[model samples]
Target: MSQFVIIGGGVIGLMTTLQLADAGHEVTVVERGECGRESSWAGGGIVSPLYPWRYSTPVSRLASWSEGAYPELAFRLLEETGIDPEYRQKGLLYLRVDDEARALEWARAVGKPLSRVGPEEIYSREPQACPGVEEALWMPTLGSIRNPRLMQALRARLEAMPSVSIVEHCEVKGLVGDRQRVSSVETSRGNLAADQVVICGGAWSARLLELAGLQLPVRPVKGQMLLFKARPGLVNRVVLMDGRYVIPRADGRVLAGSTLEEAGFDKQTDDQARESLKASACAIIPALADYEIEHHWAGLRPGSPDGVPFIGRAPGWDNLFVNAGHYRNGLVLAPASTHLLVDLLLERSPIIDPEPYALEGRVGHTA
Candidate 1:
């Protein structure tokens, strides 16, 4: 079995580690901070892309596969680790308050069964919504998961693996080897050897690759999100209004998000972004106007020129692989990404083509 050293301990890294360990490979996760505290913890936990069908076919296929894998994974993790990821199937209710033509076309393109719900039906489904809302597109298969809990459960599962080791507060500085192959990683802790090194550092992917004398064209897109104290049943399902979304959890807390800013690695919460999200949330469900805002934070999504993530091996390097640039869909695509990467590493046929997710395409592809 090949010994694999994975950089970053976010959802992608942890999930990949789990899959590798399950395949009986020796794995070690080197994390800069506590596991899963980065973008994985800060994501909205939406199980699909903002618009699944509008994305590339490869992206849609991977997302769909990951969504299907989530239920079984959640159940197994809950049973083994005694922690629930709160995987809910409440479905997504997308309101087309402005763009009816585009919404209908997108719905049709996705091939998912969608029904146009009038204001009365929408109100009946979610009474807390504001008046003057025209119609909504209901996609019943879409849902969300609690990110923090999922990360916690993944950490517990990884800890239980006899062949997996986690070294926290271990920031990777650079790679140690020639241009053709990487033999070890230079971390703040020390030099650690590995048969192969997979970089899953999320927003920091490009910089990490630069240390190995390769430039990955990944940018950090900043997103600010907020949480509100909501009553159970206040919002029965996830609501998408224009570009904003309000997600209700099993607990009484509602997630009001988010603003996508082209800020490079700036994770500070801005007051303007927070207020704008609040305004957008209140516009969708006016009852939220009175709800107390619980928390406000920001995260950096590793965005590529195109929406597709950069997976597979970096060009010119045989042993160095990359799995970053997931951007906003990292949580939804985690399972399929891990499955595909493991298959590639073991020389097995992947469920989908790995060409679209290749890292070399990042520099040339424009979206």
Candidate 2:
């Protein structure tokens, strides 16, 4: 069996480690901080892209495949770890869509559940929906998993696996070896020799790649969100409008977010973000104005230019692979992306085409 070291312990790294270990490869996950305490935990957990038609075909393919795979994974995780990921198909509703024809066509192409609905239909479903909307798009298959709980379930399940080991607060400083392969990892704790290395670092992936003489553009995009401790039934499902969304969890707490700011790595939550999100939430569902803001936080999502992650062997490095730059859809894209990464790493046929995410010609050079 080969020894694999996956850098970054967020949802992506943890999921990748799980798959590699399942294949009987001893895998170690190294994280700069606590696992799952980054973008994976901070996101709204929407299983589909906000605007499906806007993303490229590669992103759509990965997301479409992962959308169908989450339910069974959530169920199995709960049964084994006793931690509920809270996977629910409460559906997603959009107050206004700019390109109805394109969205409908794209929905048909990808086989995702979507339909055009009238204002009355929206009100009948979500009584607290925003007014003055003529029509809306209802996506019955799209839903959310409580990502923090999902993280708990994954970490718990991986902990029990003898082939899997997670290293927290262990910073991976650089990659050590020739261009043909990464023979070891230089970390804060010390050096780890590995037969293979996969860099799953999120926003900091560019920095890590720089150590390998690559210039991939994986910048950090900050998103701020606010939580309202309202009743569970206040909003029936997820609401989307103007690139902002409000998610209602199974518990009494509701999540309204977020702001897409190009703020480097500073994840500081400001008053401006809180007010902006609160205003949007209240505008969408006026009942939210009655509740106090319970939590305000921010996370740096790995912003990619085309919303597609690089998931293939690093150019000029035979045993080095990358699966980062997933932008806003990492939670939904992790399962399929991890599968593709392991597939290429094992010299097996990939689940999806790997041409778009290749590093030499367009992937890393673009960044």
Candidate 3:
């Protein structure tokens, strides 16, 4: 069995490790901070893409595959670890609170079922919905997952795997190798050798590559989100309006988020962004105005210029790979991405094309 070392302990890293370990590979995950507490934990856990049909064919394919995988993965983890990821298929309502014409047109183009729901119908669907919510486009197949619980369950299962080792607080300093390939990783604790190294550092991917004398075209796009304490059934469906979303969890907490900022590595939650999110959320569901703000936080999404993630091997480095730059769709794309990586490592057929996500052409040079 191949010995693999994965960097970053977020969902992608953890999920990839789980898959590899399950396949009988010896896996070690090195995390700088608390495991599974970075962007993965901070994410809103929407299992579906914001607009799946609008994305590229590869992206849509990956999203669809991952969506199908969620149920089985959630069930397995819950059965083994006794932790519910709160996987729910409550559907999603995309409303045009301000510009109905454009929203309706876009919804029609995307083949989403459009409905002209009056105040009464809206209230019937969600009694706590705002008074002004006129009409919405509904996609009933979309779903969500409780990201933290999912991470916890995956962590527990990984801990049970004798082939998987999780080393937290072990900051990776750089890659240890020559220009052709990576032999191992240099971490704060010391050097650890591996047969293969996959970097899943998320927003910090660029910095991590720089340490290895490689330039990657990855940047951090900051997103700020807010949390509210409210009953779950109050909003049974996820609501998207005016570039903001309201997600109701099984627990008595409603998540209203988020603002996309092109800030570099800044995890601070700006007051203005938080206030704007609150305003937009209240505009969609007026009762949110009465709910106390329980938490406000931010995460940096790894973004690329073409809105596509970088996966597969980095140029000039054999067995050194990348699975980052997922941007906003990291959670929804995790399963498919991990599957593709495993297939690539195992020399099996990949589900998606590796060209667009290849690290070589974009980064130009190799480490």
Candidate 4:
């Protein structure tokens, strides 16, 4: 079996390690912080992009594939670990304020099931819905999973695999590679040899590649979120607008988020951002104005110029690969991203076309 070392312990790294270890490979994941507590834990947990049409083809394909795979994965995780990720098909509702025609066209082109709901119908479905919402585009098949629970389940499952070992609180310094392949990874602890190395470092991916004198064209986009305690079913579905969203969890906690600031790795939550999100949440569901604020936090999402994650081999090194720069959709795209990159590593037929995600012509240059 191949010995693999993955950098970064967010959802991408953990999920990829789970899959790799399940396939009989010896896998080790190194994380600077606790596993699954970065962007993966900080996200709203929607299984699809907030506005699917606004993204690139690579982003859409990976998202679509991962969306399709979530059900079975969630079921398996629940059965194996007894920690339900709370995967629910609660659907997504786009509160329309212009961009309707573009959204309709995108739905048609992508063949996603979408239906227009009037304001009255929307209110009837969700009495807490905000006013001035003329209409909404409903994608009933879209859903969400409790991301922290999902992370818990994944990490638990990975821990159960003897082939998989996680090294946390250990930062990866750099990669030691020759001209053709990466030989080892230099970490805060020590150097570890690997048959292959996958950089699932999320926003920190670019810095990791700098050790090899390469850049991955990925940056950290900080997002602040607010959690509210409300009655269960406060918002019946994921309500999205203007790059912000309201996500209701299985519990009574309603999540209102987020601000996409290009704030490099600063994950400190701002009071101004919290107030802005509260305003948006209240505007969406007026009753939310009365709910108690539960928590506020921020995470640094991996942002790329094209919104497409770098998910293939590194430019020069034959044994090094990347699966980062997912930005806001890391949770939505983790399944397919891990699948495609692992398929490439295993020399198996990929489930999705890998061209758009290839690294050869994209961001990274030969080192």
Best candidate according to lDDT: 2
RMSD of each: 2.4, 1.6, 2.4, 1.4
Q: Model 2 over residues 119-194: C-alpha lDDT tens digits?
A: 8899888898877788999998787899999999999999999988889999888788876878899999999989
Q: What is the full ranking by lDDT, best candidate first?
A: 2, 4, 1, 3
> Compared with the true structure, what per-residue lDDT tens digits does model 3 show for residues 120-139?
66666677776666666666
Count steric clashes of candidate 2. 1
Pairs with steric clashes in candidate 4: none
lDDT of 1: 0.86
Q: 2 or 3, which is superior by lDDT?
A: 2
Instruction: Point out the higher-scoring one by TM-score: 1 or 3.
Output: 1
Better of 1 and 4 by TM-score: 4
Q: Which portions of model 2 miss their true places by more than 4 Å? A: 363-367
For candidate 1, the TM-score is: 0.95
TM for every model, in the order presented, reads 0.95, 0.97, 0.93, 0.97
lDDT of 1 at 7: 95
**Candidate order by TM-score, highest to lowest?**
2, 4, 1, 3
State model 3's lDDT. 0.84
**Which runs of model 4 end up more than 4 angstroms from their true locations?**
364-367
Against the true structure, candidate 3 reaches a TM-score of 0.93
